[model samples]
Target: MFCNQCEQTAKGTGCTKVGVCGKQPDVAALQDLLIYALQGLSLVTAQARAKGVSDAAVNRFINEGVFSTLTNVDFDPARFQVLINEAVAHREAIKLRAGLTVDNPAATFTPAATLEGLVAQGEQHGISEALEAHEDLRSLKQILIYGLKGVAAYADHAAILGHEDESVYEFVQRALVKSLENLGVDELVGLCMECGQINLKAMELLDGGNTGTYGHPVPTEVPLGPKKGKAILVSGHDLKDLGLLLEQTAGKGISIYTHGEMLPCHGYPELKKHPHFHGHYGTAWQNQQKEFSEFPGAILMTTNCIQKPVESYKGNIFTTGLVGWPGVTHVGKDFSTVIEKALEMPGFAADEDKGSVLTGFARNAVLGVADKVIAAVKSGDIRHFFLVAGCDGAKPGRNYYTEFVEKVPQDCIVLTLACGKFRFFDKKLGDIGGIPRLLDIGQCNDAYSAIQIASALAGAFGCGVNDLPLSMVLSWYEQKAVAILLTLLSLGIKGIRLGPTLPAFITPTVLNVLVENFDIKPLTTPDEDLKAILG
Candidate 1:
């Protein structure tokens, strides 16, 4: 098995033996096969769409199926076999419905009879085989595929909240088919850009779903301290799952604490209103091994970014949605098992005041103070704005983000989102005239909020976003970050600094095209980059 779809791929290259994410070769092969099956489904679905016979079930399944293959989402080979089987079932159903037949291998592909057979078949359809093309073309195809995975994740999240866009699904199917073609560098790059634009739409729908379901996030203070009571730690990026757990656990004496990317849930009015909803725990996904082991209660992984659970607390961890582990308990809507586990475990014995951090500075909250922000900018109170955001990983050199934020001029306002802010989230940056210097802009799922805030600020100042006094210093760890990068480029945003390292799949030739076209730069030292941006 060879996989390099994430920032932490083994040795900065493909993971050949086992995934650095703890995915075994069998699981990796199954994931590859699942994706191969989905491509076939997409081939048929694209034709069905052309015949005006689109199915919502097909669209939703494709989105969820594609999302499951993303790094660190599902590590269960059995689950992937089930998904592969379902993909073929869906493909066949759609083919019969549309009364059309296609000769493409992907369109006519069939799943193996058993799990072992599926894994064997999957090995034949791995990433290396899929991209048996020119190096530059393969690089562009990898970018497109990763970006599509991100789009699917966001689309699945939005669809869960009843926010469905037919065009987004249409684009997903079309792009899946496009990846199969022998497109030139220019055309493949164009598809990558198009994937970015589609991701923007998916994020928009997600923004609507999140803000629509939970009232727009308002600025709120969340504790990093411990509370005395039964506890359940909710991780990953699913607000709906978090909300349901919060509702079910209410009055059961269970205190639900946010973990990892779930830290921003405290800002949502509906979620926060739950009296038992407690504070945040841990930092980011990569630190979960130490963090999860130390947690005093049960853990529920709602979506992606799940690392291998340690033996000590592996039994205490439960997974929901598409996230799965071979031995961890998989949960459904009813979280009684999670609640029971929390009840059986020892929760915080005593309350402790461990200070707090501000969150929920999403678009609504930030833009509501547009006047003050504009005044601060005009009065020279706010010299510049730095959007230091993206996923946080366990790799070395990530300290660059910590140092970058630490060295950001006091006069500049720092807008951050996602787990990357964990580096300096607790810093005492204070506020300029009343606006906080460091603004927490929700989760990576809420990137649309950051884009909206920047667009609004630019609108108020009568200039393009690049013309604003803002610089983006981003750190990417997975496919979601890839999609976000594409969105920024698709919007014609420039001069963005990205690190800790460039993606292993991005050949130098492809990197040159990005540098030449979008002015994208690899990050240097914080001091050097700060000076470059400020000057």
Candidate 2:
């Protein structure tokens, strides 16, 4: 088995024997097969669009298909197998109406896969195609593929909120089709940029859906303690799901605490108003294996960055919306399974004081104070704005982000979102004109919020996002980070710095394309990078 679709790919090259993420060879092949099947489904979905089919069901297929392939999102073979079957079924259903034959895609595991059954094989070898492809070609293809995964994850969250963007689905399918072939670098690169373009629209739709549904998020302090009695820790990047859980558990004695990417949920006005919503627990996604072990409550993963579970207290963990683990409880659309599991956990201490941590300041909430922000800028009270955002992962150099945040000039404002902020989210960066520099925007999906705030600031300054004395020093660990990077490039944002490391899958040629078009550079150090960015 060979896999290198994440920050921890073995040796900074590829994971050849087994995934360092604990994904075995068979699991890797199954994931590839799942992507293969999704491409077929995407072909059908794309064709259906040509024939003018407009239904949430088709869009749902695209959303889920792309979503299921994101890095560290889903690891259940049963669930992966189910999605493959569902894709085949959906492809046929759409093709029957379109009068198409709907043959299986060129790159799939056949029923001959029957003998292998994935579980029994446990350690499958990588396909020669994936294992032996030219590194640049593979890298570019992976970029496109991974970017779509991010798009799908974001689309799924919005679909739950009843906000479905058909354009996003259509693009996801089309991009998947491109990845399923020997498409030349030029064509693949075009599709990669298009992924960026469409992602912008997709993000805008999600932004509208979130603010429209939850009202604009406002800055609020989130408690950082385990409330006395029953509590559940909600992780990953789905605000709508967290909101629903908050509503359902409001007075039922089940307290909700945000974990990882969900840490920013505390700032949303609608969600913060809930009496039972406690506070953030733990720092970032990477620390979960240790942090979760000590927590007494159940954990619910709504999306990505989930490592394989540990033996102790494994059953207390539950997942939904494309996040799956082999032994963890799988919650359906209703979340009853998660709620039920939370009730069964060892639970909390009697009379325990709830902890508090501050959050919110998402795009809308921050923009609501645009006038004040503008005034602060004019007064030179806020000399610089740093958009330090992206995903989190288990990597050594990631400490750079924490160090960088700690080293930021006091007059600057650090606006962050996604799990990466955990590097410094708890640092208490103080304030400039009564506003804390360490402002947490919602989830990774709320990368859109950071974009919105950046764009608004640019407009206020009569400049483009890149020209606003703002630097986007980002760290990417997964596919969702891919989507956000594409969105930034799509907007022609320039001179942004990205690091801990470059994706092993990214070829020098594709990297050049990104550099030539977007002027993105790798991160060096706080002193060096800050000087380059701020000077």
Candidate 3:
């Protein structure tokens, strides 16, 4: 299988048999085939563009197809097989129209209908095709590829909200074509930075789409406990699917609770105003196996981070928006079946009182109180601002994030996003001048919010973003975090403390480039790192 696109890769190297995330060898092979097919599709699309023809449909399909290959996102080989066939069909149609004769294997390759044949085909196109024994070129190529996966995920989300950026689509095609070229280490490294720049624009489009559609998120307290009666738990990062379920179940008895990345939905005023929208149900994605089983009602996973389900809860798991399990139900815009299942089961029995945590400090929420925050900083009431964010994982060293947040000075503010905040999200960090010391931003996509807030602060303080008293202590588990890190590096942001461990795919030579140019370092003890940042 040879998948190492995530933090949980086996032995910090590669997953060659079964994926640590429970992806089978066949499924991994299908994912590789699907990626290979997309590169072919990219070739066709790039040629089509040269002829003054661009297919938004092909662009959107490319985004969704690449996103499905992300670790822990989709494990359904059948789905990938279908996507592969579709990619071939799309490329053939586009090539016929463009009247171009490209000799790329990805463009003309034929797949066998049998699983073994598909696997054989994929073996030829796996990431090892980069074959740069030179190490640096290989590493940069891998980084660029992974960064595109993150871009696809974010761009897919924006597409759901009816937002499309043509320039970003062109960049995706051009970069994918770069993979076919034997580019030098320097050129591939430049391509990686360009991916970061494009990812920033992609994220900005997503932020606009989300806020424009859902309204700017507002600070609100989300219950840590469940509500009584029939319920449906919504997970993943798709707010559109969650909103549809909420609407369909509103007048009915079904109550909806956000899980994992969906936890931030409560801060959106449009969603929070729903009477049946109960609070967040769990900590983060990693804990879902146990939490999903314990929930009494039906579950709907809208996007990625779905683990292999246990038998006890397998039947209750329904997927939508490209997420699938072998036997789980995959639904469409209509969520009637999910609601019926929720009604058939026991939900909560009775409401529990587990207190609450504040969330929704997205860009608008934070910038709304910009004056107060600026005054606090000027008066030294808030001495430092730490952007502690990124994806969370089950690794042992992750405790450093919790411990670091635990020891932050009372006067500092911790602005966090993504599931990583779950480490200290429930902790009471108090507030400075009515601004909560611990600000919960939205999902990982909302890293744009953190960046915007920092830039605004820098402008107000008459200094560069690096000159501000802020440090980004990040923990990454998947490709989206990689893309975000690239964006930060592209901005020339420095001294980022990243952990629990570095990506297995990053070669030492590439690591040296990152360290020398970005001042990136691994996380240290809470006390020691805090002293270094605050000193």
Candidate 4:
């Protein structure tokens, strides 16, 4: 189970035993196999496109396959195996549909005599195949795989909001087929950059979907304490789920508290309008085990970053969407079970603080105030736009984020979200034109906001996204972050300093692909990274 597509990979290398995220060997292997089958699908789809087959079906296959492998998305091996089988079946069906066998991962579309070969192939020893590749080649392959996983996640979110891009899907299928062949460093590097470029479109689509559906995010205050009455802690990056929960529980004496990535949802106009919506409850995703214990409410997870659930709060943890575990309640599109679970739990204790967290600073809102921001930048009141975006982890060195934010030149504006913002979100980072420098832009998905803000600034100043005075200093802990990084790369954003650690799983081949193509360098000291960025 050698997996390392996340910042929290075991010891900053690979998770060889049980995943640090609690993914067992079987699940990891199935994820790998699922990806392998998806490659088959990608290969066939690419071939079909040559013969006039649409990449749309193949795109959905890639999106689901990659998304199924994201961190904390599916720890249930049984479910993942089902997905793998389905992907293999899809490959066969694609061959049948296209009137072609696509017998192997490397083969083009050709009708199969039986589904037996593909199914038998999937059930075959995963490790024997895993061990056949050169370590570097395997690593580069995984990098492409992880990048697609990231892109798929972004695409999936957009799909949920009804903004689908056919080209993003085609790019994913093309990227998957490219990873299957043994390519040289230069070729692999080009493919990696292309992956990144497509991700930018994926992120934009999702950003448009989200802001279109929920309105822009404003700079709002989120309460850090607990709440009173029947309550549920909602985690992850999905605002629609929180909105649904808030709607079902409206006037029902049930309070919904934002947890982890959901903490930024407090700033959205649609989500914040809920009177029953309570303040944030815990610190970050890593602190859930401590925070959930003895917490007098149920918890609803709309997405990833869910580590192993402890016994005390296991019953309290219910999941919807793609987030699933072995024993947790799986709420489908219908969130009634969440509502029922909320009703069953003791209502939140006597903790009532009616307040709002300022947000709505997405592209539309930020661009609306473009002149003010530009004036601040020109006057030196806003010296820089510091995009402190990405994942948050339990790693000790993550303290660097807090310290970095603390030490950044006061005139800089801090745009942050996802769990990473927990480090400095509570701190006072001064202001730029009466707006707090520490701006929370939704969740990890909202990294799109930072990109939008940068693009707007570039347009305002007549430059590219990378040419702005904005520096992206990211901290990743999961695969969704992988997708976001790919998006940044797809946009040609350069010189991103990623830390507290690089994925242990990325081989030298994959690392070189990223470094050479994007000039992506790891973080040194906050002082050194600051010097580099400021320079």
TM-score of each: 0.99, 0.93, 0.99, 0.90
Q: How far off is residue 390 in model 3, in Å?
A: 0.6
lDDT of 1 by residue, 1-535 (tens): 9999999999998999988899999998898888888888999998888898999988999999999999889999888888898899899998899998889998887788888888898898887888746888888899999999999999999999999999999988888888888888788878989999999999999999998999999999999998998899999999999999998987899899998899999999999999999899989999999999999999999889999999989999999999999999999989999999999999999998989999999999999999999998999988999999999998899999989988988899999999999999999998999899999998997789999999999999999999999999999999999999999999999999999999999999989988999999999899999999998
Q: Model 2 over residues 1-535: C-alpha lDDT tens digits?
A: 6677787889998888888877776668777776667777777777777888655686787678667767778777777766767777777777778776545434233433552674333233234454327767777778888888878877777777777766787788888777766777788778888998887777777777777887777778776666677878988878877988887786678888888878777777788788888778887877888888888878888877787778765878888777888878778657777777778776877645444557777777789888999899989988888888887777789889998999899999988887888777778777887887788877777877787788788889898776787888899988888888888887788888898999888878878977887788999988899888777
Sort by lDDT, best first: 1, 3, 2, 4
lDDT of 4 by residue, 1-535 (tens): 5667777777777777878878877677667667676777788877777788774655665686788788878887567656666666777677777777565634432322343443344434243364326777666656667777888888887887888988888888888777766677667656767887777788888888877887777766676666667888888777778788888888888878887777767767887888888688777888889988767878888867787889998988888888889998888767777778778888656765653344546666677778988999888888887888777878779998988998899888888767888887777666777777877766777777777778778988998877787888899887768767766776778889898888776766667867997899988898988877777
**Candidate achieving higher TM-score, 3 or 4:** 3
Provide the lowest-lDDT 10-residue window in model 3.
Answer: 126-135
Go through the candidates in order and give each one's C-alpha lDDT: 0.92, 0.77, 0.89, 0.75
What C-alpha lDDT does candidate 4 achieve relative to the native structure? 0.75
Which candidate do you rate higher for lDDT, 2 or 4?
A: 2
Per-residue lDDT tens digits for candidate 3, residues 218-301, read 989989987788889999999889888888998998789988889889988778888999888888888999999899999999
